[model samples]
Target: VTLPPKIVPRINICSWTYSPPHTHTHTNPLFPSDATLEMSNLYAEQKGKTLNLTEDELLTFYGILLISGYNSVPRRRLLWSDDYDVSNTAVKDAMRRNRFDEIMSSVHLVDNMKMTADPFFKVRPLFKHMDDINKTIPIAEHVAAWCKQFIRGKPIRFGYKIWSLASSSGFVHQMEPYVGSHTHLVETGLGQGPSVILGLAEKAEVPPSAFKFYHGNLFTTLSLVDEMTLRGDGSCGTMRQTQLHNVPFTAPKTFKKTPRGDAEYLVEVEKLIVRWTDNSVVTVVSNMEREFTETEAKRWNKQKRTMDKVRQPKCIQDYNTHMGGVDLHDQFVSRNRVNIRSKKWWWPCFNWALNSKDLLSFQRLVAQTLLLRHGTKPSRQGRRSSMAVAITDATRFDSFNHWPCNTGSRYKRCKNCGGRTSFACGKCDVPLHVECFKKDHTE
Candidate 1:
């Protein structure tokens, strides 16, 4: 049951900040007056009555998902020169070709002390300098951990992908005392978010799924759909041809405004999600005047009590400020592409599938597998072991849950021969034998 060291050492940490609240325009969503100073301006352009965030403003939301423990793909990331060099396009290509598991990070657990903690958020950063930092945990430990969840106990294949996402200036290091009885893999992100979920399906047995998102005013929906369709209650040929699946959930027509400049409206929709079954109906529902009452806040607070055991500290001290999880992802982890976009507006409109939140929704909307932890590069034979990994090689029985090689680490991959090749012989009675695998693949 030996496991590999993580590739990224520092625990995945996302950094963030938030807006103090104020009076929201009818078009904007609600937040406490003390939540942020930027709330008013952001609210001014809250374009439709629905869709809380456009793609541009997704970083704020991405911060939220990071705290929720989902490896939502960030639009931007902080990739180190080393990570890019070692993982190289070829290694990633190979890992993707051998995807083994589809699960991302687990949901954030609750704790008893009301501390609102998750494992990575709890560990304090003690390193005075980056070079003298712990290498194995950040680099090999975290990556190896993520890999263990995905590839454990699966046979390798080609054309699979492995991904990591977070929202902080994180770090990874080579394992301590480089030579030891146990080998640890490692990986860490300076800032991480859901960057890893984009290609999960190509390598996963259980790939990501999508949820139908219904946002914006009902009138907006009506107009958009009406513009493309002349008929009622059926798929519009134009929309279908364009691959847009928006269909009516309530009234087929638009909502009319009342004298008060306010109108009662709603938008209903269906999305595709997966659990243990297929194509689950994710009927997302919300209404106007939406606010989290004390009861809902209390519910969240109670869950906070249970998840305290998991929180840890940020790897980078300079980027330590955080306010809820998504806030961190928004400010630090998400990558911002160079833009020649319009600047007529007072501010930058971060619209696109590039922000952490939008990408997160993309992952969930499309059912992308998420990574909870980073990874390790340790192999049973050596680093990045691909021995006996050819098409003809026998499947290994212990790929799924090998013993922690050291430093409380393990490895998993999502690139495998579907779920057909169970690495752990006992988990399911797959015919692949461990001895046969070791004999042929041992380096």
Candidate 2:
């Protein structure tokens, strides 16, 4: 098939310039508040009511959220507990527990009326309004798409299963939630895996011919390499032996019987396939590199009980180096992830994006600056927090404080049954009936 003509000029890969959409005019920290306002407004619109949430309240909400990552608790309300060990003075002072709950429950990025029936509908709106503002490689040659599943043995074993596209340095360029066969763009012959990579690459706006994509067996296939090569891009990834339709590679079972350092390769229509044995066996495919050069790598020798240096294919070495971008990004995101529990599935994805690098200082600086400029403090001030004494059964059933005495002429309503009574508890000093004297304290 004839390849499409290129419109973008291909310059020296090492010398290409990157220009950001916006340049910094000043070091003012309050600039980040624009995002906060936009998010808060979006949420209010989604709420379908007058939220009346001020900038301070919203910042305080974020401040409390950032603080949660540092101070985790079994129950979210425990953050407002009277117990000094469980409670945070700053969090309690910044906002009330109910207010925090209200914001957390109502916060959203898109209006429900416009939401599509897609699997990613919950968090798609957040991605829709987001802009790429991070410093990325001028020419991102090492791009990868990997599945972050919610299965057991994974760090995040019970969250959204997402497909991510990332750069070599672990900067996530784009993400799409896995939605079965319909999740990615449909390529009639490429199937779901390669289609996912294509969809993410298209969405990420990666420049043609400037990237070398990497993935694992799940996305790699003989046809995928040819398809990518046709678009002036390169492909390198681990491949299943079965995916090689016409290539004559030794069966994995037969290859396992060979020596540990045994290797094989085949060149078909400019595509290269390398199968090597180290621990077990590995097969790699690439349209970008050949098996002309090999590198040495250390492997544990079970029989000899020593480390042995084995010859490794260059394509294999490159795959090992560049395929970890998605994994690295996952590690960074989960390190200080917001732990606020919400029933809304979208909250997790939304919260992941909202997490800032400088957790404490970002919100504090923005909130304080806005407050100072407006000459107003947070709506809720720090009050003397008192523990709500629990009326335990032990205290109620105590036999000693049972004395009841007659009050003056006027009778007051019983604390328990709401009946007027002239009698009162001598110790508790609350009006109670003689009949309820025992049940009032005990039951």
Candidate 3:
């Protein structure tokens, strides 16, 4: 594939020249809000600069550019490279269209709990517009066609964090056939904190009931399986790790005997296919920097040790096993600190206390950010976010609080109570009450 010439040149220019001030006036609006994002670039400062990206020696720069996007502290900041840069021309376009600034400003406003439009701006139009409906159905059919046409009929995996990635649902819905129609659907990339483990437990890509959640901190999920087997036999005797219902845990039926027959690894196999990993194992957050503040970071590391300690017993009692110290990746590695006090190896910073309450609270924070990026909602002070999508007062959406609490969020409408909620079962923390949950469904 041919590379974009400006991609290399533009990135290098920005990394070297752009060092944003640590504390800028938040109200100054560094970039304007009234620009169109799709048609603009944010850079014009490097007009005369010449950067060659078509050289063989420069090919390595593309890999670097891509990895930098992954390794950067926040993962959002762009990096410089010898080649394959996004030009200042692009930045200028972004600013002129007010796209980048608007997106960022929208994220910022939502994090602060500001309203952005009625929250369901697109959703309302989505339901009403036949053209929009026409656009939605074919993507999934195309995905299935592409897979069958190219891959010679193999199972496929589809994924999205239903709660946090509500915007992605359209694409997923379009691609729904590839997921629901007998493909090896795999999904992951849950949040990085305690939610990481809970995400695993919820089994977003997989069914929550299919697997058990163990408090035991195995060297990895593989090690956990090794311990779960019957004495010298290959039987998967029943024992619960992370519990949902009274489901029996079974060993790999056809899968556990392959060369690297680790059933624990099955969940990621779907990811390998979707991301073009070609059925090979690849690492995402492999070499982490573990950076954090001195005083607070230490406290977090210590608490993790305590949680690790607590989890160790459950792991051992259930599966006649033992392990060394807990691993950060197993639980969480602080940016760069050690948790010396966590009775469990996996105590997280925020939701380590209560999964029920804290999970919703943190997710709410994330949802607010999403609202600002995609809506016409104004903040409390009426300082409109740049990414705000304008909808008339006649148009309204479910509040940010009404977002689905989990990946399988179903909009529900209450019958008797005339309320709208997201949970079909009237489950608490589903982002709406039973009345609203059911009402939304009926309406």
Candidate 4:
């Protein structure tokens, strides 16, 4: 896949210093003591509770909470009540004041402010400097290597065998060089240039084998078509001519109109063009060995009292199935995102780290839950249970508790023992006889 040569400019890096607000000399009622004093006292008092936790274990816990969906430390404190003996106000004060070192010290977290020490912490420097052509290949290789190292305990193939790279317009340029040979790249929005494609193939360490490119109809530029035909890349001339004539350079009003069914139209050739119900046309270019195939999707035809078969392009179908992982991840991050609104330029990077932490925690939780439900060890040789079972089990037994009945004059028998009573179990919110309450709770 040879594309035109065009240089994308690299972003210039700048340095900045962060200094705490000038509140050290002033006495604030909310924060009574200095961070160091407060943290020391907190550690002395709560040391017994967290004595069992190692430094790494404590750091992991803090990392999870910091990146958790809870917007503030107070909310996080509520969840950690069972484990940590820290007050909500204390947690809030430490975070709000930006006392990272003090908090770490209090929790006995090692590395002494390692989380906050780096100004460019959690920023992807690769993306920022990718436009520097000289740096692109090295950065991609480094990132791929890092990914291979950081991810452990399971084979990468078990998760995503086919890496699907999809991003908003200009963003894809930075990522193209790293896309694996078997990867499917989906470029959304317009303004895709030939240089991006050629640069990816030329620079990326990943070989150009069975790579598929899925883009919006607008991305199928006239130059791209010319390049394909000129290279004699097995593209049908007539089909190319038809596509050049039929597919508008700009999106049409018709394309903007939403369809009621699976897709408005589907055209399959060496390349596939699918106009989906969402009023978007997707163009896919594939070099896979398999022939282009269409699957039948049945929709209920109320007027005809029958099921109507809808033809869906294999490319579109595959895109729909695999493209959702990224969206799902974004949804998870957005739903439980930390609320950090800062004027500091590095805040975005910091926020990204927090989101990453949340994502890691979410993934771990899901994996653990799945492991428990399946009762299987994490290993390549482990046999999976074929039978489908519920991920969680429902409560099997019921117990009675004592509570005061809200209904003053309403006459009813006790739910537990069938005896009339004015009081109810507040915990269970069930009416109970005084005699039955003792026996129900005891036994």
Candidate 5:
């Protein structure tokens, strides 16, 4: 198949007397040398002046320009040389470095101080909409009042707190005021240190027992021994050292042979460590006391011609089950996300909260539907009687002098009932029995 010609820019190098073309062009297409020169020339042509850029700066600038022009296109379809890939990586690295600088400048680095206590550092706006909903008080005061009311009401239904906690990024201080003194179960992703977890629990007026944190491997490593050492087999070199320094007490080793004829090991260090057969370790930090529990799984055994047993820690099972509630809520929120882009740092967060409210509203509606479906049935007559009652409740009647009925019957039947008609509704223009007319119109 004949491939289309590559789209190369037509540059007028005649105007450039200082730099020679040999200094820019390269033999290899992958490491094209002229990328910087081409960008510099283009910049000069556009602004009608030369840019005094260093070699590194020129490469950086060229990358940004390249991305700005074609980043929207798919990577495979981008008809550019391999140099574009190198430039893209450089641009991303530069951005990451600059982001770190920006964060350091914006945030204060403090050891023991509570950043949430800063009154001016608001994580969320006081009121998203103020003009129509709340006009009597200042936005701040209105927000305060609303928080108190929300706390008292406790808007979320049961079994949905995990969804709420995860979707909010586990920032308890923002929700603490609104949640009041009620203890709540909070779930958080990795990077939450001991200080952060305890601080959030304190602000939320809940004990550490209420928090279930998923500590990241990096953060866990800082506090605990290497995961390899904690494996059940005691094969890793550091097992003896880990037992002496890290664990308080190690459980008796349990073994179960898998269907694949491989032995699986399981061990627990009371409440602290749980090492499963998969060589994964979990470090639980909580104030609540939990007894070690195990669950049995059935596995096929070819030699025995029967199902073999596989043991799993209850902690690991629970973690696996409940950890993704926030993720599910996030997926729901992302479906109708607002696509507005802005330079303001907080705009992304603001957009997220706005989109999240829609999810919460939907959850409430679903809860209501479930309640209505399963809740107590009201004491009433038959279905027809109930329909009559509903229709009567919705409508009212007025008297009229004469009403025409299109019914061809010599003796008209009641519109509401099968009984012979004696009266007619003036407004509805329907003939009705005296009793049916009174039932339909009497309020």
Candidate 6:
């Protein structure tokens, strides 16, 4: 996570300027007054009746959603279950189960009266709102694809293919869901890859020249690098060998025979292509300078039976340093996402929009603030782990009868810290370490 040489770290923290009533300041940004009013109006239009959703009800619903990220149940109704051990009193007190179900069913973002044949029409408004928010914060951009891929061992195996632009701080600037080849893409003419990069660059609203963009091989073409140079932006990325147009670096056969850390580079006017060998051949293309101060990277050596240092080029170092913004953003969103299931195609993306910040302290603060305003009590445990994770209901936390017992032969991952354990709650049937049993259930 080192920033590139040209980039200077700027820290600007907002103060908690809220007066006595702090509710509006915390919740309003995520769900604005106009947005909420529009949602209620849309609900009535869809359901053929008035769904008078007040500010309190909306905040409570969001609070419940936040809580569910940690305390998940197989069914939503289980939150209000009749069984004392499994039931949640705060949830039951905040809203009726049927009312929750009603809101879920009628949560419309756009009017159905203006329906189109497009699959994305339902959730289009949400993306628009997100993009509008991004415009308010001026920053350079990077790109990534959020999609369901059949790629082996990929974590996100089933999701929509969303092309997104994110800043160096992991803030998403804009997003467009990819449909297919017929879907509109910028005509960079180099291919779909360059087109996506250019499209995202254009959408970011900043002068293209202001960006020092970094991308992976998927979007890096020789022409794309040249195109970025023409647009006055510096660029660097790993390149597919095929996109190289047969640039004569040491021939692939000869390059394989060279010693580890050996590098062959071609310097054209204002562009650089480098092939460096470590465990595998790394081909990097950059519009930056040909020569840069070289650094060393530790690599495992099978022959020496130890880690050895390999020479690393500046372009490769810069790419590594700045290329993880989208990935970091993905990591933040994936963690602590609400465990809400839906048949709608847009549910995951909608949930993603809400869970933008995966900071547990913020989530816990927001959850407690909103829920407590409606009479839900905070956790009695004062010195719990900062992580907002729990498997059991908060209402059941005070039931002093719980204990851990061995599972005899089976070992399962601990619910508290993900360590392997054979011991588990005697009643709940969840695995946990002996020391974590109390904290896990109570927190």
Name the best candidate (by lDDT).
6
Query: Which predicted model would earn the best TM-score?
Result: 6
Per-residue alpha-carbon lDDT of model 4 for 248-334, expressed as tens digits? 322435534534333322232333333433223333433221354566556677789997766655544554433332234335446
TM, every model:
0.15, 0.70, 0.17, 0.37, 0.30, 0.71
Clashing pairs in 6: none
Q: Give lDDT for model 3.
A: 0.22
Q: Give the Cα lDDT of each candidate.
A: 0.21, 0.63, 0.22, 0.34, 0.32, 0.66
Backbone clash pairs for candidate 2 read 141-212, 396-441
Model 5: what TM-score? 0.30
Model 4 collision count: 8
lDDT of 1 by residue, 302-338 (tens): 5445522221111111112321223333332244322
Q: For candidate 2, report its TM-score.
A: 0.70
Q: Summing lDDT over every window of 10 consecutive residues in candidate 3, give the lowest-scoring window.
A: 9-18
Off by over 4 Å in 4: 1-67, 70-98, 101-204, 222-292, 298-308, 357-443
Write the residue-wise lDDT of candidate 3 on 30-134 in tens digits.
111122121112211123322222222121211222222223322222221111233122212112222222232221111113334443221222222322232
In lDDT terms, how accurate is model 5? Answer: 0.32
**lDDT score, candidate 1, position 252:** 15
Candidate 6 lDDT by residue in tens digits, 261-305: 677666776777777776667778778676644677887888889
Q: Is candidate 4 or candidate 5 better by TM-score?
A: 4
Lowest summed lDDT across 10 adjacent residues in model 6 is found at: 10-19
Best of the two (3, 4) by lDDT: 4
Q: In model 1, where do residues sit more than 4 Å from their true spots?
A: 1-164, 167-198, 201-246, 250-327, 333-443
